[model samples]
Target chain A: MGRKRTRPDNIRLTEVAELAGVSPITASRFFRNPEALSIGKRVRVESAAKELGYVPNLAARALASQRTEVIGVLIPSFTNNVFSDLLRGIYDAFESSRYSIQLANTRYSILEEEKLLRLFLAQKPAGLIVTGIDQTPESRIIMQSVDCPIVQIMEIGPDPVDMIIGFSHADAAQAAITHLLAQGYRRIGFLGARMDPRVQRRLAGYQAAMKAASLFDSRLMVTTPLPTSVTLGGTLFADLLAKAPDTDAVFCANDDLALGVLFECQRRHIAIPKQMAIVGFNDLEFMASAVPTLTSVRTNRYEMGRNAATMVIETIEGRRPEQPIVDLGFTVIERQSSVREP
Target chain B: MGRKRTRPDNIRLTEVAELAGVSPITASRFFRNPEALSIGKRVRVESAAKELGYVPNLAARALASQRTEVIGVLIPSFTNNVFSDLLRGIYDAFESSRYSIQLANTRYSILEEEKLLRLFLAQKPAGLIVTGIDQTPESRIIMQSVDCPIVQIMEIGPDPVDMIIGFSHADAAQAAITHLLAQGYRRIGFLGARMDPRVQRRLAGYQAAMKAASLFDSRLMVTTPLPTSVTLGGTLFADLLAKAPDTDAVFCANDDLALGVLFECQRRHIAIPKQMAIVGFNDLEFMASAVPTLTSVRTNRYEMGRNAATMVIETIEGRRPEQPIVDLGFTVIERQSSVREP
Candidate 1:
């Protein structure tokens, strides 16, 4: 082959085919399905395409000129296991489809989510999967203007641009607290961090349950806006205990916090389930192996991700979504950490 | 203002301009720099472009037809802290740039990596950052053919495809083993899981250190192919303790495994640093918070990621790489988990 030429994107496909000594149809076939061509023709066509700076995918690009085959997904947190598990499920669902997810991390900030949304809107993706229902007014207006299918995940809202796939955080948190109450523990304290929309919803859930049981106490809640970590768990639990020594059980917003709470209890010689019954959310792998084996709310994050992706793909392929609002509810797993013996 | 029309791939840009009652130059200018035109002109041009299915970035496409403003990143694992830290660094480096990472999870399978590479190659990304150096032969050939800049990360290899940014896992492992020997642990053991290339290299490092000390014993090492987890650490440590009851110290391949070993020690009432000592790799966020703060090799994953991205960006912008092979190296941290009492 002669010296490699830059993309003569200036030339036509017929000219490119002539340069490669092939028919226009053959050159077109090479881009769509090179497997159909023999090795000799395939190599020649590729070399000619490279030399001519061939950009044959234009037809394909034009086919979806309004929107690319990208499935734009927005999550509030990147490192959080909750979102990562959803990503795993999303990947699994789109694994066989012609779609690929364009992931954006919003740092659990509505402003950041808004910024990311504006950027994604420019691309006009085939569909979008967003986290939570709370969006800036400007962001919601943009969402409403877009004609493509949109799926809001992690929570259900009455006014979705198109669709939603998630459960009630309030109900889940209420169930966790009720579980502790049913086990005969009152004066339960809560530890929370990174008070994002979901966490706020969970707190509301906790408050509602406590109030219904005539045990609501603002002094029992310890919270911070800082990102959650194993150490934060200990710090928050310590704060809760210092203020409410009468605290008999604690419900952690996340497993990381629970791990910290467990470690703090171990350090203070506070007996678990005997003196303090603790519970966590998300039911991550470590909860099962903790010293006392922590109890946690088990939500089907993978299923949510998978279902969301499937919904986007089906909608993009022109299949009407059977349901616009899907509530993949949560379940609380009874483990040793939160269970007490009479 | 007209009814929504599909991309008319067959029509020319001039017809689109006339239909929207705008000059062809104004239509072209709108796609090139919409900010240059007034809001009304911009809207008209955009509608014309939409109605005609105009792909106006043709000039921009020709300028970089072989690539887009995307940096394709392929990693063996996604949620792993080690890789996540690297991602944070990569993002930090590219934070100010026009580039965004198009991440693909290979899940530690070479075939999957090869498959992902083929798809990315078709997109003709601006650059690529890949994990490890052990790509399939077929994959390497394709990498060689692609003219875009490529950087290999996570391990410093003698023969890199183009450029490399990482440290020596074997050396780090040897250092850990040597640390235990200095602490007076004679019957030290090694526990590893998900023996990927890096894990195998770590095992090599351990063997090298033990052999040099005339303490090499295959019976002291326990391994499995299951993905690493805290619970896996406990199970593997149990197997090691069962087979070699005299085992006084252990070096874990990853933090998850180390956490498990620590938990197991706690469960068996084995006093850390008294009856047994432990060390882990990757010094994750939880290492310092563990019951007996775990000692570990702190690899500069974030820095490596940042450096790799910086290198790719500079090279793509036509700057010569100062050094094609960068070894950031690793550090061993001393903590209570591996600190023997006097």
Candidate 2:
């Protein structure tokens, strides 16, 4: 084996400044605010810095200025479109600000969230933007330790860690249930994904709306552990028909699950909004183009991301944002899936 | 109006070191390599660091040691599952290495890639992982200036800047086409997503294979814009059928597009394999579970990610990597979609 290699000597700012024909302070200013310098100076400094392979001393800056210009983003999953859309919005908001984002995925596990929190805390980003507030003890400790601003997104928490920016899952679910109820869907069934706290909250909200309307019966609620796939939705529908043959409506967890459920209904010769009504959450772009146009609760995922990013950036700059608790709100999109003929 | 308030002075590492009864150098080493130091001293230093709200200065450490322990990843889109799976593999490899990832989506735009490249360079990450090799002139300039290792993923280029870890898209496409021909699929038509350079290479390979086999008829190839959803795939199939009514087989750019074509066949009461055999690229998980399981080209997406991450990490540590060009290989998976009875 080769002998252990020695550490490379650090490339200093002073050397870079000398190469760029500028003072050390000017070199520091280039790293802090490259745009503040003239175009010619910016080009010269960047060229010299690149030639020297210079990396700014972020730790020293953090100690002296208390700013890292890095944002921490905690997301549920990268596999889904909703979260991806939200991330795109956050990215757009910070594009011009030169603020880099650090992402951590919870993978739908509360335990994983705690681990990610500790990891994120070690980095000491300028601010934090998390999805919801169903955090573990260790996660809470990490969040409490963060002196920077925090913004909770996707769903409102009972008590926010700092700022809150999201639509109410309960309200969105209630809207879907009420739509089914209005269409004379008495024996309605609820289909959902497995183990997400937010989805569970939606299920609870759906049940509450049904109970408040005095329509909570044994035949109406059917829960199953199905993977979020269209085929699973099809299989679940078949099982639902076997259990409760008279079920006239179904409320799905989200659009992907709903699409699967719809495909099954179509295969079984079930006329939607005629024999059975279907309602979904998250009015994804495909919902409108879907056959029979799916009726869904439209949560503004992109706006939620934009608002959360904006709040975090503002708080990082030592500005108190006007609204710490931002409820972007949701809308019930009426489509062919739930509209019945008079 | 309230008087302008002054910000609190940031706490320094010197203060934490003083409180812990250790030198600032020892404290810095503790933050960089905690496990290497004595446990008794580690506990005392960690406690003091925590008590003093000491955020280990990352910028300072970067300046001093020339290692940021961060990796920059650039992808075209996260909405695609193939890219996401690749990312999962990369994350798995780096999880234990304690390297954080900063991701940016170029949205398949060269201009966006150039801009994002500049932003990534400013962070001074240990290594860079880019999705494809087709970069802009400005991006090329910035990439060359970085002294650290860079790995290009997903597609192979004629010449690599530093490292290339991916499969040959052209070869994979040719294999798919030859497999179709071997299965006696003549009058085969190609249905592809938008003209991404990589996808175009696959199309070109298909065209070459067709011509070599003396089957290069005008009616055998079809091309459309990409970012194609399953719905679009379905519509495109219908349009293709209207034009080439005698077409016996269709090769799609990806599984999503193939699924759409398959769905359209089901809708039109057209028989699969017997009427129109279908082949897809990227053997996604859903393809295996799909109703008449899809025939597809399986690229080692996860392995691609793992290899790229490992190479970057090892290169950063000054280890001479064994291979700079890694082709994990691809396979043609034959399922019900393209199978025909004798």
Candidate 3:
């Protein structure tokens, strides 16, 4: 669809340059690379541009330069709090920079991600930050062929497209299980929702840890393909209790589920950490303030996002990161929810 | 910063056209206006493009047409669950459409919104969906100058730049208070954080309702300019108690604070509804599933987002909405948290 060309009070760079008593090139340089311009010229251009309400034509500039000052970020779910924290870090990193972010939601679909990737690449983004390491063969080929630096975030794995930043989800889950085991809780159960690639890995880690302790039982785990929510957490926990009535501890895939389990326990008059201990992943802000101060695995989500964006920006500006793959790692934060009274 | 123009295996549209036995114009038409092309020609062009691995250069198309198939969206916060639900609706609305969203976070600053508005206008987006009604005077003028359709979301007010869709926050808060009043609760207090314009309106509503009952006391309220969180909710609730020890009910600015207040009440061994009633805004999923099920003012956030995007796209496609200003409204859901025993 063609857009209406009705722009009132259109201001030109040449007009701003004339008003500021500077060359058009100087004014352009003030917009593009202001550090290269003299202080006097930069100040004059800025003031004149402000006075004229001159907005540079980014579309034309993008065509001329064959690239946009846009860093394309592909995230799985907008509703997930995890990505929101990551996005804050990404936005915070680019706040003062010239580049603006163009975000796309893949809805946790690899095919959708691939499609979005194609669309983003067509625009010739300055750089890209994709969600995870798992990608289709065609998508990987497309990414490898692109010249801009790319960062795969959320989990670190072998053979990254370019740079990678994230911790091991499996390791984080295993640590949470280890903490529960050390707290003298046995017959531990697993509760998960929307078993995405990362959640699946977490489940794998839980199974491994339980198996190592000779406590692994398929009946102790309950999962649903429905999108994760607090309500779903309670429902899944109830299902887990029905399937394994003697369950002493529960490990949730995320904090929302853990919070749900806590609420369900309170409703059922079950004393937390005495009858049932709870552990969750992604120690969200609410976890520390919950009634029992829920125990959770703390992943460096914000730092991962910030570092990934910085790496892409640095590579774009000619400074490559010394470490191409960074595993920020995770910590199992033990709170009152999982601590038993000795 | 200049980019490396090293796109490997660059496939030209001319080669696709030759392979498809069609003119380059037909190949180009397939990407832009496929509906206008004959089925045979469209099929041939699609296959040819697929075989050649041709990605249409969006920058070049944007320059040629002077407009992009981009619908710019600006939201205040990324971490807030309220906006995340809104974003999901917006993304789902644009999922199958040719237009992609270019999201910008203003971080609750009107000045930042103004800067982002200017940047978005410079690119000549096909349409725009901006959050809230409180835009800077210059920003308003800039939006008015642009030809693209703009929809202001999150709150309905007088004097929209183009179309508008949202409920009244003040009215919603007033309703929540009314529900509490009807439940036989008096001496209600207010808990707020992040005092944004919308949250301020909610506070105003709380004050108006309290004054109507002639039970309003300045000491019965506690608020902070700090960002709202569950932890902050608990801390503010504690402040409210210290300021007004006789407070029997509390209305939180958002669900996070409400949840925090619930957790704090649990920690303090205060009976919910019996000792202190709690009501929250933005009925998040966790509200209905909490131990005592929380009461909340449920605003049509997802519908607001979907309707706003649809309005923008409809206007861009040469069809104007019959009702330019839409107030979707809100519902005060009564649950165990606010219902006192008969």
Taking every candidate in turn, the Cα RMSD to the unseen true structure, in Å, is 6.1, 5.3, 3.4
Q: Residue by residue across A1-342, what tens digits does model 3's lDDT show?
A: 765777535587888999999999889899889999999988999999999888887777786777789999999998999999999999999888878888889888999999999888887889999998889999999999999999999999989999999999999999999999998999999999999999999999999999999999999999999999999889899999999999999999999999999989988999898999999999999999998999999998899889999999999999999999999999999999999987
Please identify which of the two predictions, 1 or 2, would achieve the higher TM-score against the true structure. Answer: 1
Q: Please list the residue runs of candidate 3 whose C-alpha ends up more than 4 Å from where it truly belongs after superposition.
A: A1-54, B1-54
- Give the per-residue lDDT of model 2 (tens digit) for A1-342: 854667445567888999999898888899877888888878988999999888765556764664577898888776667887798889889877857788887777778887777667666678888888788877777797679899999988668888998978888899888988888788888877653777888888888998988988665555565446666666666777888898888888877777777777755779888888888888876666556778999999989888899898888777879877888889999998898888
lDDT string, candidate 1, B1-342, tens digits: 754886534456677789878887777677656799999878887887777665444324433343577789999876577887787788778868877678889999999999999888767677999999999999999899888899999999999999999999999999999999999998989999999999999999999999999998888999999998889999999999988999999999999999898889878999999889999999887888878788999999889999999999999888958899999999999999888778
User: Clash pairs of candidate 3?
Assistant: none
Per-residue lDDT of B1-342 in model 2, one digit per residue for the tens? 754556545457888889999888788779877887789879989999889777655666665664677899998886777887788788878878868898888888889988878767765788999988899877888898888899999998778888998988889999998998999998888888766878988998888889999998766667787577887778778878878999999999888788788778866778888889999999976576555678999999988998899999999778948888888889999998898888
Question: Which of the predicted structures, 1 or 2, would earn the higher DockQ when compared with the native?
Answer: 2
Ranking of all candidate structures by their TM-score, best first: 3, 1, 2
- Residue A17 accuracy (lDDT) in model 1: 85
Q: List model 3 lDDT by residue over B152-232, tens digit each.
A: 999989899999999888899999999989988888999999999999999999999989988789999899999999999
User: Compared to the true structure, candidate 2 yields what TM-score?
Assistant: 0.84
By lDDT, the candidates rank as: 3, 1, 2
Give the C-alpha miss distance for residue A291 in model 2, angstroms. 4.3
What residue runs in model 1 are displaced by over 4 Å at the alpha carbon? Answer: A1-64, B1-66
- Provide the fnat value for model 2, as a fraction from 0 to 1: 0.30
RMSD of 3: 3.4
Which numbered prediction scores highest in lDDT against the true structure? 3
Per-residue lDDT value at A164 in model 3: 98
